[model samples]
Target: MYRSNVLVCGGTGCTSSNSELIIQRLKEEIAAKGLEQEVNVIRTGCFGLCALGPIMIVYPEGAFYSMVKPDDVPEIVEEHLLKGRIVKRLLYQETVVENSNSVKSLNHTPFYEKQHRVALRNCGVINPEDIDEYIAVDGYQALGKVLTEMTPQDVIDVITKSGLRGRGGAGFPTGRKWLFAAQNQADQKYVCCNADEGDPGAFMDRSILEGDPHAVLEAMAIAGYAIGASQGYIYVRAEYPIAVKRLQIAIDQAREYGLLGKHIFDTDFNFDIELRLGAGAFVCGEETALMTSIEGKRGEPRPRPPFPALKGLFGKPTILNNVETYANVAQIILKGADWFASMGTEKSKGTKVFALGGKIKHTGLVEVPMGTTLREIVEEIGGGVPDGHTFKAAQTGGPSGGCIPASQMDVPIDYDNLIAIGSMMGSGGLIVMDDTTCMVDIAKFFLEFTVDESCGKCTPCRVGTRRLLEILNKITSGNGTLEDIDRLEELCNYLKENSLCALGQTAPNPVLSTLHYFRDEYIAHVTEKRCPAGACKALTNYYILEDKCKGCTLCARNCPVGAISGTVKKPHVIDTSKCIKCGACMEKCKFNAIVKR
Candidate 1:
């Protein structure tokens, strides 16, 4: 009934930027003017275009405001909410027009011009805290339909035809997993949802659970019904307070509405859900590890003979899926088989949600078709590399993934395509890198993460990954030899061949991928005794270019160690021993004097 609704982002990104204060200010201003009845302020989940947060969208006109601060709220309420005028200065540049109409809305923004939000359909569009809003969007209708009409075989048939795969790193067939649990003859069965997203660059699952929580709830319920289970557990990390809060709210709301618990929709289907908090171990991402964690035991992976669906979660037949995988369940059942299958590529069907981060123009959640090329995603949609640097590599997955070079820029982004080119789809985190990125350092960075995060349950992951880290540390510190490559290759293969779980199995990916794509850089580190990208501090030497130097003395002033010896209007000499390779000299030199060689 309100004439205008000021929607402020309640997602973690904007909330950190003081978006909640903006909402409070707007409410106070509207109430002070006695316009509270006509104007209302609401806090919602992430709007996907995260760079513009703390984002505020004015309704009726759909005027998009990006990066509005706490102080800016009063002006917005007074000028736009009260007087019915638009904030010209605050409007996003891409959507702005001269006059008459408001900016073309978030849909017309350059960053979202090419994004397709299938997996993220109801994410930014609905209030995740409110169960009614999710229901209004046909949220539990799929569960209702599945329970009342469809049989277990029918549910399996629909999902199988849809070609939906697990969105949790390993791309196993979702229907097949359910069928395995359904076929089992255990006295009791259970379903579990993996919400412990541990990848550094990944937030796709977190966003879905935060934005459209009911979708996961409904999907889990349907999964429970489909697999002949009466109980479920969501293994989520306690670190994600926002996501945890929304999920708890959704569960309570579902129970209140009879969407969960005994006799769901009066169909003799008695089911309920519980939550188990993860201590935030990366190894718990593995199926056996996750089930073990759910049982309050030490989280680690075990060899797979009888997978989770056959015998899991306290020795009960259990089917496990990650947040993103479960998020697609209701849609696949409601929209039919071919509808979901029609999207993505042959091997990988249905769109995948990617957490686009690291050096890209747009760093947020994106869901694109499977066959979408890496070039189109980075250049056309990601706005290419920020600051006009040439694209070097993109690291997909997380510490477990690999760095992709520019040579495979046109490779179709799918499961097989990525694995074939020494990379994997992982759980959909695409981190863009530019020429300034050092491949050796990047590989070392990921390997270091793998080494620290390894559960030590297996010798391959615990011992081999640690040894790989030592070699990477040696190479970066300028102590490597040409024979190190052969040695590193030997270790990587040994780890791969003798790994216990997927964590140990893919631990050597980053090292192998970088070595395959940027071998010249590795050779330079050994033969030329230099870091090609000037990233490894020990192998790099910084010097101010005398010809390019205008003798501004900015480098000398900015250098923390006073490495540059220079006087005004005279060329400078860098004391190499005193230089720290922090790039302060390069940042201060306006004339491009500070050079890395």
Candidate 2:
């Protein structure tokens, strides 16, 4: 047995930061120091603290290292591994005690203390490429138990009792969907997994796939048994090369071990799974659209008089759950319904995984119980917003969700509460905004995305979203009037009511939410012809604060257009007509001289 194991993050964030090179250098150094046998170097998935990647954790001691460089490998190997000395400088600052100079466990850090990981339990813990490591951690136990001991209805009953809903945007009841598919009489029903993950600031589903693909496969097999289907399909976007590769490996390994193919676990039940790659269409995240893409047709949503549970892929009864939703299945089966149900609120049970990002410290993945407050997530878990910026608003659920203002920070984050407060618990993407963020611009950004991604199958989505974007563009460009603002509100309601699919139905959410919470900013844009946050280029102009300017000739020197004119050691003035509003001069100014208003 090895005396020490060094686990390096192999997730996408760390990989892009050259964690692989760090791993290679680590092995080389270990070998050079003759510590190869005593030290094991393994590549694992994301540790949920992505900002400080490439992350390294030395186990047994559980020494957490952040932002490791390739050049630091030799020093780490010689001092920490070979000589039994800890590299205090490389340690995550939070993991180091203040006075004692002692290193603490990563779990004790503020970032992870409040988190309750259920779907992400296996992430950062196991080597995702290795199936044996997964089995050691009781990977297939849930499927085995279901096949050996439980009937199909028993499995469904447990899931139904667990109070689990789909982690995908809609928040539909998972067990009820399964029961509907199971009750249907079909010769060739199908089970499909949605891994498209099209949300802009979201990566929860992709991380789950890259970290614990077997969980999804096992869960799908269990689902196939429940729904009486022999065939399963995972419709994943091709952009996730790592997740896709690992999923294929997991499938092959499961089949080799008799966990996936005919008569799995020595039972009469037979099931198998396949993969279908999407071209990264955002609308395919909708269930019917995903099934359409899987069926080799254009990815577009169909009417929902008969949902997928009634008639789906290949015109047969089907059930589709996103990656994060399926990741919870095996755990619920193994741990029992009460075990899962006991963690969350009365209505929303079990922990939810969120891709925490935008203007926040500790920006990464967090899994919190359903009833946790937005304040808890933003302040306690997220380490609050960085750079001493005051929290302004939070945008959840991507384009489909609305904003929650700072006033509602104390509200419990759940399906119903978010909806009540004009936001929805979307696919678990929580984007925090600082005081500097323009709420009107934020609304426009999401509207632009929706307009670009609309499938055009419905006139309301295709035409109405474009009109909404046009009005937002007009407002931000300082050409809008109060009538335009009223028209925006009216058109948003129209799209919500007349849209064909969820893509259109929820397209107006961002606008509606911002209008409710930050309408003052919107009114300022139209009525006063100004951007309150100084974010809109057309509504703002640059000026050199005369008193604050030291006139080091820095602003004038750095200005690409020579907008500033002044001598050394004197105040500078900006030629506003010549200024491009690039903010380059402000960024370069040592003194806080330049202001945009």
Top candidate (lDDT) = 2
What stretches of model 2 exceed 4 Å from their correct place?
Answer: 98-102
For each candidate, give its TM-score against the true structure: 0.98, 0.99
171: Cα error in model 1, Å:
0.9
Model 2 Cα lDDT, one tens digit per residue, 1-597: 999899999998999999999999999999888888899998888899998999999878788899999999999898888877778899999888666535887778889999999999999999999999999999999999999999999999999999999999888889999999999998899999999999889999989998889999999999999989999999999999999999999999999999999989899989999999999999999999999999899999999979889899999999999999999999999999999999888999999999999999989999999999999999998989889789999999999999999999999999999999998988999999998899999999999999899999999999999999999999999999899989999999999999989999999999999999999999999989999999999999988898999979988998999888989999999898999999999999999888889
In candidate 1, what are the lDDT values of residues 532-569, reduced to their tens digit? 78888899889878898888888889889988897899
Q: What is the lDDT of residue 65 in candidate 1?
A: 91
Q: Per-prediction RMSD in angstroms?
A: 1.3, 0.9
Q: Which 10-residue window of candidate 2 scores lowest in summed lDDT? A: 97-106
lDDT of each: 0.87, 0.93
Q: Count of backbone clashes for each model?
A: 0, 0
